[model samples]
Target: MLRLFSVLIAAGLFLACLTGYVLENYTVQQRTYGGAGEHLRGAQPPYPAGGMDNIFWFLQVSDIHISRFVDPQRAPDFQKFCTETIDVIKPEIVLVTGDLTDAKERNRIGSRQYEIEWQTYQTILKKSKVLEKTKWIDIKGNHDTFNIPSLESVNNYYSSAIAHLCGHLHTLGGFMPVLHSRHERGTLELELADWMDNRRYRVLVFDHDLFSFVDLKFDKWPVVVITNPKSALYSSPAHEPLGKIKHSTHIRVLAFSPAQVTSVLIKIDGVTMGSAVHIKGPLHTLPWRAKDYSTGMHYIEVRAQDKAGRTTIIGHKFTMEEVRLLPFDIMASFILRSSHYMTLRVIFILVLLANILVIIAFRYLTRPQLKESPGFFALVNFSFHVFSKTNILYYPVLLFTCYIAVGPWFIGEIVDGHFGACFVFGVVVDGHFLEGSLTFLIGILQLTFFNIPLICYLCWCLLLRCRGAYFRSHIKYTGWSCSVPMHISMLGLLGWQVYACYLLQKTYGTAAFFLSPVRTWSVILALVLVYKAWNLNNSAIRTFKADMKNCPYS
Candidate 1:
């Protein structure tokens, strides 16, 4: 029974090592700009239980252009939108892409005008009480910054208000802060709405100035209109392609302005699908369906107008596909796009190897009388125990580590306004592709310098278990088989993980990286391991002393 137990330990460790390696490699190789890249083309799942049939709706509003130069009625206009118009639509979430405020004038740098504009923006939201009803996220635009020439006229505007934009965002609720590395840039993730199954969609948002106005439409308050049919990427004047949808697929559209916007109109191939039902809510989706239309290239267009008679129009050609209800495909699309076909085969082989190791360790091998005769298998058996059951916190620590390794993807889901699905993992490891891979490099450095060394040190402790007699004559060794050094090493790893969490917090402008449910538990797990190790080591020392008193040699 003792031998069988040892074999099981060995098998478990071997399996864990293999699993860890496979997951790490898959995550690294599949990292993409937004996530899963082009694999998102057809990964939409079915709607949730309460999802609207044949229609998915979301609101898009952009370029409020809140400026100090605007008339006094501007504040009231924003208020009416949030309290009256937006409250009526009641969308699932609202996307305020960029240009929340206009700061093109260089003279406004030190005039306190910039502060007032932001104050109005905040006050409007507060008075409207819309944030609680809907998820509203705003990014940065060129006009929101100081003296951005390309978007504005190229003039020598002596302004020092470059950093003020982020300050306003920090004060406003729902917007993510600007991230700084060598330069300040704004970033957010947008997950495409999925159909009923597990289709994953994510888009990365950057806060920076554009080189030309040609990209403004898509870059502004962007809207993705998913059509049922798949067709060539048609160049729309303003909007970009969201994804491919089936006949019954749900689509979300964000309206740029609620106050200036009188009503949002949706159409399929020149026929009105539905006028988005407006309500007294912060966010609402205009649900529409396409049952009468046959499968072919169909045009999906949305237009929103304000009280001033200004209108924004965007349309795209969509190819409708035959609907087939299947299981989740977003994750499967990622796996298929990752091109790691060997994962299943490798897992199978690893399982078989583990079983063989168990049989050999328990059914055949025994602790040999001679030290050298026991050889590498004995060392492996001992090493397995080092990872499997050295400290009382072994399982807890291991589990915690695994959770953080994959927690970022789920967090991404929250940012993208989706729940009950995790399309990707390893947020820190994958990093933002546009950010010059800074976060990615940090992840690699942590693994190489911290995790690898910690594992090596733990494995080295197996040597201590080889046999006291083998080293007894060399230096008059003591029979103290305690895990003091191993305990210290684990403590070091725990300390380093805490530091890593801080690094992420500094970069992201929020402690959310470490404070996440997965990472918070990691800290507690490490603390428990530290305490347990100290107690076990003390007990081992006491037991060793008692054995010495009864020794024949004594």
Candidate 2:
């Protein structure tokens, strides 16, 4: 029985080691969620039960520099950590807030360098469209706006568009939604409709120049349409691909001077919509067909007339969109020690071998001397079996360490909006969780990886039994058939190192070079041996107690 126990112990230790190695080192697949190059994120469960708040609003971002030129003091900001925060959380809406690029600084005049910056932004947006379905909108951004010779050549020419919107022979004051601010101060969208009952519903367009204080749109929810809350308006033009555009759709209403000899009129090619009085303070609603207007690749012209009937027609056209998404490799910015992964397998095998040698040497040395005790064989067998010293205080530390090592793998699910994973993490690793905070790395080496095995080995030593002088060294073990046994979940969890390797390969690809099968099994081997040692000590102690009671020692 004692010899059989020894065999079982050795087998268990070897099997555990093998399981860890095989799992850790395999290669697998490339993981890219939501198509974004950088999807890495800390965990966050699902949205709270309630719907989003009305006061909340997200930014409309188009072009912001993140490369070698990021500046904090200047216009473009480099500390884009907030941007990442927004991306993972999935805000309400992000309209296209334009001009993410400049002339690239080398063009001498910023007018010619659109090719590099323009395309990159578009691709990023397309990939990051992981927000809730109804939230994403792409308004025309200035950087993406058409490059033309004059204001008339631009698609959203501000001044002339407003003049034609009023239905008068001449008009003044209204602007289209254009480049917004780098930091959206309040609600991203604003409405000024109630105060402008008499005026047309005008949506003020803001871009680089339009941001300012005292603007009525300030502090208001973006749903508000009119810019000048007190005035009603219209603007530039709302164009269609096939029909003539009415420079009448997008605009902001400025100061209203009623009865001031109105002359502005809106027309679609040949038909005139109507005429307005220069003194009309507000027009009430936007052009009848404003919402259906065409955008990029489309064109329109609005004719504006001053109070004296001095008229000029301004035209704006946008070419069809031809840009495509950027390639995914752009995220290589975070890569370190890139490789084909050649030496990983060899190193792991050698480590496993060394560990086995150490285990053998430990068993041979420092064992207690034998004594002429009748129950020695029975004690050895009983002590080496089940439920032994493995439960020593050190195990709490090891369990804590394993929790840390395996816990970070689930952070992705949390960030992507799964509440369940959060609870699971809390239950498994205690509230603080391992690898969650940054400083965990400093504390990890001192963690359980080494100590857990050491504890198990120590317990196994206590399980050995000896008899006569010739058998001076104690060595024997046993197993008990009837026992409640520890929870299987604990054993399964101990084997998690194997699963972790498979998981790594599954995420990064079977060819990924970071982990090796052997490394994973090494952990398993180490833990299993610990468990067996504890089992041996418990079995031997119980049988020794029973045998001595039965024998006539008196």
Candidate 3:
């Protein structure tokens, strides 16, 4: 009945996994929409006839990392930008990508959500009054997700946004704009430089259906965003409709500078299209026939130079048709985005399968036997002769096996300020189970390689003794041969524990010593076990001939 039950459960799990795999593959192929660079030829354009007239601008900031405990000045600096720079730009919207607060403790080893940091972030927004001036959108970064059980948890202090924006990498010196492909089907991914150090932000302008942006430093001038001929790199008709550039009559540019604007020049395909005339504040226009270059993709360059000799040149590919990401880019994006969940899934499946295999092997080994078998069984019977109940080594071996099965292998702060115990079952963080922990993986390994084998060896010995098998005459000759493998497995497990301790010390600092006392003890235990196993294996081989001399056949 037990075997049938195990077989049924295994079959069900396999079928469920196969079904999910098939469905997932089918869904992915259908969602790809004919793979990379394929466009819907007859799709309606995003912008109407007068694309330049429908323009709006927004401000984007990322990786604020506001930490009152670490960098107290960052909060005030961000506030200053909100008040001074934001007032000048007067953007229609403000998008904060992520990393609103630094979740690190003073030691920088542990992580937890600090209410004070979140309150500081909130106070800055309210004090700046920037929230009232524009639509503010903020999302959680990887830092925000640390130690958070879920998004709905009270510990999660992030303001909700339409989409999630990542700011964990602090990539490109936080000065350049990047589009991550992992965002949901119509979502746009924009990563901004950190407000903690660089004081960088982006001014993104959308004119008609064309999107143009400029990365700006705090108080820096000559902010330029091309208002016409949208960059082809950002073209996504599935998400946002694009304008038909064939109907455009003039090139439009928005350039802002504290000093006098000297020249705003336009270029198409590297050829000069003449200087643009300043029509209004930050608005420059140059007449061009968009129909001439409408058939193929063309490069548009806008150079804005001020009286202060500050030259800012921006270039982008513009085309009338839609553009799609390459297949490799799409696959990479999917892998990166799903990496966390994928790891959890893979580990869970591997552990599950390992346990199932252990159960099957245990059942097969302990099956009822009419007569003693040869090879491995003969070795087991011979080894059990030394492991009889009366032997002095038997009690020590049994006691050690039981201790390892139930003992607390290590104790540490599983999450900031929360001390917990690790057992064979799993790691208990505070009072709750720490899901998807690597410590738990180690426990499973110990059970498979060390505890189970030792327990089986002890049980086999008792079984032979119950059958009235006599081994006292050969006890002095046959040493603990089976015990060697058991000790070696324990040594390996202890070695793994030591490596884990080293990693903890490297990552967390001196605090690891105080937090995990078992790490130090494990090293001592491993050395002792290695010495005992070596002595026992050597004694067993030396006594083998003596045991054969006492046999009835000899």
Model 1, range 250-344, lDDT digits (tens) per residue?
A: 33443444354466677778987665544322122455454444454577777766566667676765543332111222332233333243443
Best by lDDT: 3
Q: Where does model 2 exceed 4 Å of error?
A: 1-488, 491-497, 508-519, 526-534, 538-554
Candidate 2 residue 193 C-alpha distance from true site, Å: 27
Candidate 1 Cα misplacement greater than 4 A, ranges: 1-329, 332-365, 368-378, 382-459, 462-491, 494-554
TM-score of each model, in listed order: 0.28, 0.23, 0.59
Q: Among all windows of ten consecutive residues in candidate 3, which has the lowest summed lDDT?
A: 30-39
Which model, 2 or 3, shows the larger lDDT?
Answer: 3
lDDT of each: 0.41, 0.31, 0.61
- Quote the lDDT for 347 in model 2: 39
Tens-digit lDDT string for candidate 3 (333-436)? 44345554445446645654554444335434543332323355554544444343223444444444444445665576554455666654566775787544
RMSD values for the candidates in order, in angstroms, are 19.5, 25.5, 10.1
User: lDDT tens digits, residues 1-554, model 2?
Assistant: 69579979998998898566433322122221221112121112221111211113233333343222334222212122123323432335544333334433342322323454545444454554434332544433333333432344423322211110111101113332221111111122222211111112222332111221112221121122122111101111111111112222323221221122234444433455454223223221224353243322333333444344344443333221221111112112111112212223333334434444333444444433333453545444333332232244234433444543344323222211211122112311223332222223212322334433444433334433211101123322222221112223335444555555555344334432133322344455456554444344434445444433433321
Residue pairs clashing, model 3: 46-241, 46-242, 174-193
